[model samples]
Target: MNGLHLIAELHDCKCAPRLLRSVDALRELCLTICAAPGLTPVGQVFHQFGSAKAPAGATGAVILAESHLAVHTWPELNAVTLDLYVCNFSQDNSVAARSACARLIDAFIPERVEQREIVRGSCPK
Candidate 1:
């Protein structure tokens, strides 16, 4: 199956602190982002690293029909990592994947970003 994998490292985020440290906030934002790009989310999972009294970063994954989206945050470092992969079996999903990835990057409002697009499983030019 031909697929696209989007990876990004975000640094010095300027977004709301809750988005970086709150589990619920991150989960909601992720799910919403997926849908806007016409990506079908089949299932999801999220976790908070620290306690409510002293909240830390969160991690989550949204399982999609085409593939999945994984996100990890580090409030202490003001950083985030995002990975989204979508396989094009019956139809091409590359456009949607890129859209979703860009939206997520924007949401974080990172001052500096390192991003890459990898075509997997023998892609055509």
Candidate 2:
């Protein structure tokens, strides 16, 4: 399944209050963004690390029919990293992947973003 993979590092992000702290909020955002790209989400799992006294951050992955999307947020540093990958097994999903990635970046509102796109799996000869 040839695909496109998008990776991004966001610095000085000004995300919504719930986005950085609440697992529910982040899950919703993932689902919403996935839908925007017409990706079918099979399931998802998110975990919040650290103690109640001093909350750390959240990390999660959304399993898609095409591939998957993963994200991690560092509230203390106001930073985030995201991964969105979609396979072209059935159709070309590169555009959808880019659309989803763009929406996520917009939500984060990062002052500086380091991003990259990689083509995964070679085309059939």
Q: Would you list the C-alpha lDDT of every candidate in the order shown?
A: 0.96, 0.89
- Tens-digit per-residue lDDT, 41-88, candidate 1: 999999999999888999999999999999999999899999999999
Each model's Cα RMSD: 1.5, 1.4
Model 2 C-alpha lDDT per residue in residues 1-125, reported as the tens digit of each score: 68999999999999875687666678889999999769999999998777656657888899999999999999888888999999998789999999999999999899999999999999855
Q: What's the CA RMSD of model 2 in angstroms?
A: 1.4
The worst-scoring run of ten residues by lDDT in candidate 1 lies at 116-125
* lDDT for 53 (candidate 1): 89
Lowest lDDT 10-mer window, candidate 2? Answer: 48-57
Clashing pairs for predicted structure model 2, backbone only: none
